[model samples]
Target: MTPTHPKASLLTRLARLVRMGSHIAHGFFILAVRYPHLANAERAVITRAWARKMLSIFGVEVRISGDNPGFYPPNTLLVANHVSWLDIIALSSGTVSRFVAKKEISDWPIVGTMAKNGGTLFIDRSNRRDASRINGQLADALSQGGCMSVFPEGTTSDGFGLLPFKASLFESALLAKSRVQPVAIRYLDAHGQQTGTLSYVGDHSFGLILKRLLSMKKLVVELHYGQSLQAGEGELASRFAISNAARREILAGLNLSDDTPDTARQTLACPQAVTQ
Candidate 1:
């Protein structure tokens, strides 16, 4: 079910107006660069505010589950599932965290600009050398108490299911000895159908989605936070275990049965005992 507002023309106008306002706000970041001391925290604040505004303009509402823990030690790494591009806006609006995304996203038109301006880390998945370089950079960022959000499921999917999480990226958590928080995001349509429009799978065009969103009256997003896991004795084991637990938490939150007959649902061995 789509939005049923009679004032389609009015909403369209409002959406464009809001987009203009966002561009203006985006420009303010250039001004922020002059003041080094205020850049970091201010950018975070501005990014969050912009995310909130964008969601508001798109008529999407966010509902969060579990404890919204404040960034502790300022070096926490959040691992979550990727749904649609909208997931970025939803999560950013709720947390002042930076994202770790694929290198291709860095070349997208307006999105590329926003991701770069928002301080997102882009990784080249096709090149092992490049991936290694990014891993090192991520380690350094976490060592310095910088928080980052990563989607362990290398790609996005419809909100109904999860993909196999790539364990390689989890190496950064071990390197920095940082806490890994599992997060789940679900998107729904106005009539409560799990439209999964949030997932950018198949041949769906970003421009087409953006136009549809402009006409949409309401969208619902759910964010579920799970227990944080610590790096264990072995990197591979630790990553596998954490990713499995995260998959379970996300599936449970969606009210789906855990007995689904899919390879992705298989559990892995736990490297170390989880505190939660």
Candidate 2:
């Protein structure tokens, strides 16, 4: 397997950072203001284009494979294994959907503001009641022909294995009868070998991860979309089964065994964090 890229020159990293900041500013100040007036289809087009540009600014290329549901069908719940903070950007390049993220993410700096404006649904994991409220909102959105993406793993991984899925969120899919599309995401080097160049796990500061990402020569994000799963009529038991099945599909897409441990397959070559 090919190794990760050596750090880019300081000047190159600075330039890329500047471009990304400018792009984000444009989205924040310009596009966000006009988003409310755009139709759903128009919003999707703009969202996809902006997401592609964002990744391009970071010098990351996204390669989509498997049952690629172009732009994702309406009322679909796109489930995926979490790998990096950049996972949203990679997936958004091919499909447009509001994301379900933790309440803490909505409190982050620019990212939080952007996410809120981009129609993300933030759930307060510490509050059990907040989950039910979010589920109601999800069902309402999906019933209104909206698409959403949720990472059932609930945390970032090292792109080698997956965490067990939280079945509670799948309840929204059943409520709306939304199709669950399992997507497997990976951060790889130019040669297509998996790399932890972008894993945003543990206590690594966001700024530190950003700098490492900026320094990488080439980062490839692969999204392997599995077949759409029908939620069918279900109670708690059915939701649990569906969640497990989704995890299985994602693991298969990552070419990992169902019993694969959460340990990293290869050492992450970037800055390491001592704790989450």
Candidate 3:
């Protein structure tokens, strides 16, 4: 927000904080008291509702295009590029799917507790055993026809191209004979240009992210869904191939160069926004 004067800037910041605080109270009440009593399907509905409100509170807007969720297979594994914590909210607002997040997020402030309530699947990356365990759990989840979304990049970058996908998660999809859906998330500024202001990266504290988010005039997020990937009878594709295909589809949606360097993808100054 380009305030004409110092006082205007300060007032704008204060007003934003007030709005943010109000939304925090409402969201916290839902998470702490309301979310627990809801059934699994109900929880997804509420989570999606809260996600939309969360973005509204932060002065963010979302535009969706391409394949619809209804067209997705009943047993689907969603793969997408990771950019910021806002990616979770943006995706959840659109899909009734559970997320695969890093286990450390379970220890974050209120968000961790909320994520748990939202049915997030936490994977302990540092523990080699955790991967195997989560894969099994994912297979079971898919077998039950649950929608699971994952960031195969294993980490977030400034909004741009994608990181190489870790192929292990694709193994779970293969085991369950589930369809894989590639999703793309992009953050744009007011002029419809890609912007790093919405990115959460580097060592910046979450507090700093909150400040940046509140101070922003607006944030525009775009989501694109690609065609589903399934294993054909008599066609055996390796997990690596599936992962590469998913990553390629996401890169295409984001309009990024294929096999681009991380440095080339994120050419902006690191102004972290939301999460890891």
Q: Which should have the higher lDDT, number 1 or number 2? A: 2
Q: When superposed on Cα atoms, how far off is each prediction in RMSD?
A: 6.6, 4.3, 4.4
**Compared to the true structure, candidate 1 yields what TM-score?**
0.81
Q: State each model's CA lDDT, in order.
A: 0.65, 0.78, 0.72
As a whole number from 0 to 100, the lDDT of residue 74 in candidate 1 is 66
Q: Pick the candidate with the highest lDDT.
A: 2
CA lDDT for candidate 1: 0.65
Winner on lDDT (2 vs 3): 2
User: TM per model?
Assistant: 0.81, 0.89, 0.84
Model 3: per-residue Cα lDDT at residue 187? 82
The regions of model 2 sitting more than 4 angstroms off are 1-4, 233-237, 263-276
Runs in model 1 lying further than 4 Å from the true structure? 1-39, 71-73, 108-110, 233-237, 261-276
lDDT of 1 by residue, 106-171 (tens): 677665665676567887666766656766777788888777778776666656676766777777
Best by TM-score: 2
Tens digits of lDDT, candidate 2, 9-99: 8899999989998988988874568888988778899889888999988888888899887795799888888766678778889878888
Estimate, for each residue in 88-112, the C-alpha lDDT of model 3 and write its tens digit: 7788778768877777678888877
